[model samples]
Target chain A: MMCGDEYRESLRRLKPEVYYLGEKIESVADHPAFIPHVNSVALTYDLARAPEFEELLTTKSHLTGEKINFFTHVHHSCHDLVRKVKSLRALGQQTGSCFARCVGHDALNAIYSVTYDLGKKNGTEYHQRLVNLLKEVQAKDLFLSGAMTDPKGDRSLSPSQQKDPDQHVHIVARKQDGIVVRGAKAHITGAVNAHGHLVMPTTSLKEADQDFAVCCYVPIDTPGVIHIFGRQTNDDRKCSGCLIDQGNPEYGIVGGEALIVFEDVFVPWEHVFMCGEYDFAFDLVERFATAHRQNYGGCKTGLADVLTGATYALAEVQGTVGASHVRDKLVEMVHLAETLYCCSIACSCQGYALPAGNFMADPLLANVTKLNVTRHVYELARLAQDIAGGMLATMPSESDWKNTSVGKYVDKYLKGVADVPAETRMRLLRLIEGMTCGTALVESMHGAGSPQAQKIMLMRRANWEHKKRLAQKLSGTGESRHD
Target chain B: MPGQKRRVSLKYCGSCNPLIDLSRIGQVLPAAISQETDLLFVSAEETNIDTIIILCGCPRACGNKETIRARALRCIVVAGESVDAVPVAEKDISTAIIKKLKPK
Candidate 1:
């Protein structure tokens, strides 16, 4: 796999036209606003090279028998699934943000297994085609953004029912060599700074939606491709003035998302994985979502550790460190954090292998894990804000703190204790604020298929008939209790 | 962009049982001190990083930073809420509030 330095230098070669504000991004690598998130992804490359993290971050490729970054390695056994989460957690903690690879990690794994079944049914060479591309990805340490969510024009309407057909990404036309695709992929994570886009259908499909059920890999710089970088809260803080104003100048609020428009982009036959596979599209979505759901268990928990730590450190800096309630809250935070980890491990541990040999996470437990995260990670942030106090919200901007005329007076008042500096106290609160509010918080709720999505899976996985029979047997209204 | 700013190597005590949330300091301190200094987190295997800023959730400060290879210029250990006794395992976790008995 390419090392961190190589990865950073590699981006210089690709010139994807990424727009932010009104201007086009000339150099994605050096752009101040994009650098932090870019750095976070680069850290993944760096961490894999670390001696201690090598075991969790690097694995052998099943197809080529070459050592590959765990991000590219297919899960050959249940242990591989479990190890995947561990690696994600390790990197999440290291970056204190999203590394931007896990979505693609799950996407590649999901597509790997699904194509095997597709090949068997259609007698196609989809599996081998994907395997070859993935081998190159591993050797190059390529970054991929899984483009799944679409901009559904109307919530109540299906893809086919949309007033504007392009609201959902679809096949515009088919050619002898390949096909042309059009429409936008919304909230595409790491798209502006990725080597490739792993495109897939966002939802289940019907016969009418056959044109919408398109999936393929497209290079980010494909002709007619347009990337509009999504705006992030306090993003400008990273650019001109004080770096401290940017809550995480090092990582910049996890993987910065973008809206990518595939304006009649062509995909060669070699790159097209699925097209017009409407009957299986929904299954494709289910496989992708379930595979992706298992990530929150590890990544968010890794984030939770940081959230929990922030609460503790800030309390100490403010001289309000030790209170009984504070202790209880801290304890609760750890309990919730560990609980999520347990769910992730349980799901991975119980995963069964597919015919393609990669093991997908247990759907029920994966859903269960993400559902807990939707609540627990929020609570973790709430408790953080609680311990850190309103100062977390009301703290002066870093600019005010650095202002020559007002800086001294501001520092004099905000000072927490004799030993700890006022800057330290306020900055800690800002970090808490950055992680707990706005996009960060909402991402937890909606990302990886929201709370309702998990509930639907749980209900489907529930053995209601068996459960009812058990209760009936106890009441002597059904079959005997003994099996 | 200041030249020759001093650096602080950050360390966090494990989040077992504590009065304060320790990780917040690590999160906020970097930005707080960014104008005049840099904060480098010294992982366990890392050594000779800089002055260390040790954040402990509570007073007990269960030994999570002792193993860091970094030799700080000076160590800033911030401990949070000092309770009389540390609970071995989230002690005093009763479901219902037990009121003090009133004498008749």
Candidate 2:
């Protein structure tokens, strides 16, 4: 795997046509606004080489017999599945935010797991195509962003019924060499920095929606592709001359999201993984969603750990760390965060092997993990905010703290506990504010699909009929009515 | 001593979240150690050294320890509040490294 510096150089080499605030961004890796997010992405590479994290971050490739970053690895067994969550948590805590690599990792496993079944059913070579791609990715130690989540125009309609045909990415034309696709993928995490994309259908499709069921892999900087960076709150602060105002300056608060439009991008035959596999679209979506849901346990809880640390740090600076209420809040924050961690581990441990020999996390438990992540992450953030006090909201900007005229006043009055500098307090509070505010909460709510999506999946997988039978048997009325 | 030579490879992780500056090891110990023992930079792809010294920026020890082969492995983790080394030092790192390299 590339080190952090090499990863940066690799990103700089990309010729992606990216835009930020209506202006063209020539080099995403060099842009100030994108640097923090790039740094977040870069950590995934560096940590893989890091001695302490190597066990969890690097694994032996099954196809190539070479060492590869865990992000590019297929789950070989249940232990690999458990290690996935552990590594995500470690990276999450280190970055104190979404590292952005997990999305691609999750999507890779989903595609790798489902293609074998698809091949068995249809006599397709999709599984071998994916295996070849996996070998290449492992050899290069590259990042492949999982591109799903289309910009569906109407909530009630399917892909085929949409007024704007391009709302969901589709195979628009069939070429002699391969096929051409045109459409967009929205809220894609780490797309700007990825080496390529593993594009999949975002929704279940009918026979009429066969064109939209196309799944393929494409390089990020290919001709006819355009990326528009999505704005995050306080992003400008990261690009600001003053650094502390943007908390977690070393890493970003959430995955840097972008909207990528594929303008009739051409794909050769070797890279066209799945073409018009409409019936398997649901399987792909379910596998991807469940794997992604399990990740909430791994990454979100890591973020919760950082928030807990920030809360405790603030309490220390304010000299209220010893207060029973402050201590209680810290315990509560840990409780919620750990509960999410438990969900992640439980799902992974319950994972089973698919036909492709790739392990898939338990669908029911994975959904449960994500559902808990939805509620507990906010509650943990709330407890952290409570422990941090009101200053997180009312604190003056870093500029005021360093300004010439009023600087002295801020230094004098804003000081908490004798030893902690006013600037230190402000720095901690800024970080606390950056994460707990609207951005993180929104991501936790909507990133891996919304809470409602999880509930729906859970409903489908609940096995209510079996449960009813068990209830009857326990109540000594089993089969009485049937007879 | 009859021309006994020892090669040591050094590696450093990017100081993303260093508790203390990790460059001090290179600054203070490299020159002295190079005089008594061979100091080298091993590519992640190569493993020719007799000893590996991982200079980590913090307790996280964020370096590729796996497959980075050597006869002996030692780490110096520069933590936020403390300096944790494999063999505790009582003086300048150069003198300590020299002592370690040239055993009596």
Candidate 3:
């Protein structure tokens, strides 16, 4: 597996067309705006090489029996599923932010199983093609951004009914050697830094929408591919060269998302995993969503651990740690965070094997895990803000703190305890603000899917009729339909 | 048996949330083991390693799996406050490990 420095150098070798703040970026690896996110990913590589982390971060490849990064391994058992969660939490604790690799990891697993099923049922060669591609991906330890969400022009209309055909990625041409696709994938995590993209359909489809059921690997620097980095709250702090204001600066707020436009991008026949297979689109979407959702409890809980620790420290610094209510709020935060962890562990423990011999987390429990995250993370943030007090919002800029004139007054007035420096208090508050504030908080609600998306999955997965039968059996009121 | 010391190697699970102090155990184990038994600690990469010591923070013993154990003739697992599935106190863990390495 590649080491952290090797991963950084690998990004330097790629020449992706990435634009940020209306300026075309010359090199993403060197840019301050992108460095922190890059560092977040780099740690994943570095940690795997450490002897202590090797057991969790690196695993032997089932395909080749060689040691490889866990991010690139396929799940073969429930053990693998549970380990995935544990590994994610470990990385989350290390980075204290989105590590930006799990999306691609989920994509790989979903595609692996889905393609195998498709090949067995349809007598196609897509599965072998994917295996060959995966061999290289594992060998090189390449970073791939899983690109799924499309820029749906109208939510009410399906892909074929959209006024603009390009709203969802579709096959624009079919040739003897390959196919050409066109559309844009929005809010793709780790887009600018990744070596390539594993693009998949966003939603299920019908016969008329067959053209949109396309999944292919596109290199980031491919001629027609263009990336525009998304803006985040307090993003300017990165470019401004201020240290303390940008809380958790080493790993920025959320995954460095980007809008990737595919202007008739061509893919070799060998690289295409699915095309005109509308029937399996739902399977791919559901599986990918399930795998991705299973991660929130692990990663977010790790972030919560950091956020909770910050709140406790701030409370102590302000001389309020002993208060009963303050202590209660801290306990409440732990309860909520651990509740999320329990959900993730439950789903992973309940996981079963798929038709292709790979395992997946229990769908209902995984969705429940993500659904709880949407509410609990916000509550965690609110409690953190409540404990932190108003200085989180009104604190002077780091520059103002550094100034020789008013700096003393700023320091003298903001002091909390007698022994602790005001600077310590300010730094702790900034860390909490970064974790609980704008972009980071919003990611919990919508990153994998919105709350409604999980609700939809729950509705489908729930055994309502069977549940009704159980209720009838208990009440002795109605005859059992069929036990 | 009187003059020669058995060579041993140590590996660790990347302590993300270790329940025990792995670093402290790692620091004192070499001298402790040498004093108690005719065992000399060596690098994990040594080809002639007689026994591999896998130090994990939890019972998960992630480093004690087949792939890791396949490195040497025999393996010893130190998970949290336990050695080889037997409970040991934090203060006596080093002595317990030393006991295991001593000849019968």
RMSD of each: 12.0, 5.4, 2.6
Candidate number with the higher TM-score (2 or 3):
3
* Model 3 global lDDT (CA atoms, 0 to 1): 0.90
Error of 3 at B7 (Å): 2.7
What is the lDDT, from 0 to 100, of the residue A100 in candidate 1? 88
Clashing pairs in 2: A49-B63, A49-B64, A50-B63, A51-B63
Error of 3 at A239 (Å): 1.3
Higher DockQ: candidate 2 or 3? Answer: 3
Q: In model 3 chain A, where is the ten-residue run with the lowest total lDDT?
A: A474-483
For residues A1-483, what per-residue lDDT tens digits would candidate 2 score against the true structure?
788889899888889888889999988888888888889988888888875566578888888778889888899798788878878887887888888888888888888877888888888888888889888888877888899899999979999999999999999898888999999999999888788888999989999999998888999999988889999988888777778888888887798889999999998878877789899999999999988998898888778878888889889999999999889989998889888999999999999988888898999999999989889988988888888888888888889988999989988887989988998888888888888898888999888899999999999999998999998988887776878
Best-to-worst ranking by DockQ: 3, 2, 1
lDDT of 3 by residue, A18-136 (tens): 99999999889999999999999999999888766777788888899998999999999888888888888888877889989999999999999999999998987888888888888
> Which runs of model 3 end up more than 4 angstroms from their true locations?
A479-483, B14-16, B21-39, B45-51, B59-77, B81-104
Predicted complex 2: CAPRI docking category: incorrect
Pick the TM-score winner: 3
Instruction: Give candidate 2's error at residue A210 in angstroms.
Output: 0.6
Q: Per-candidate TM vs. native?
A: 0.82, 0.85, 0.94
The digit string of per-residue lDDT tens for model 1 on A16-129 reads: 979998899998888997888889889888877764455567778877788888888788888788777777777767777778888888888888887888898998777888
For model 2, the DockQ equals 0.08
Q: Highest lDDT among the candidates is held by which one?
A: 3
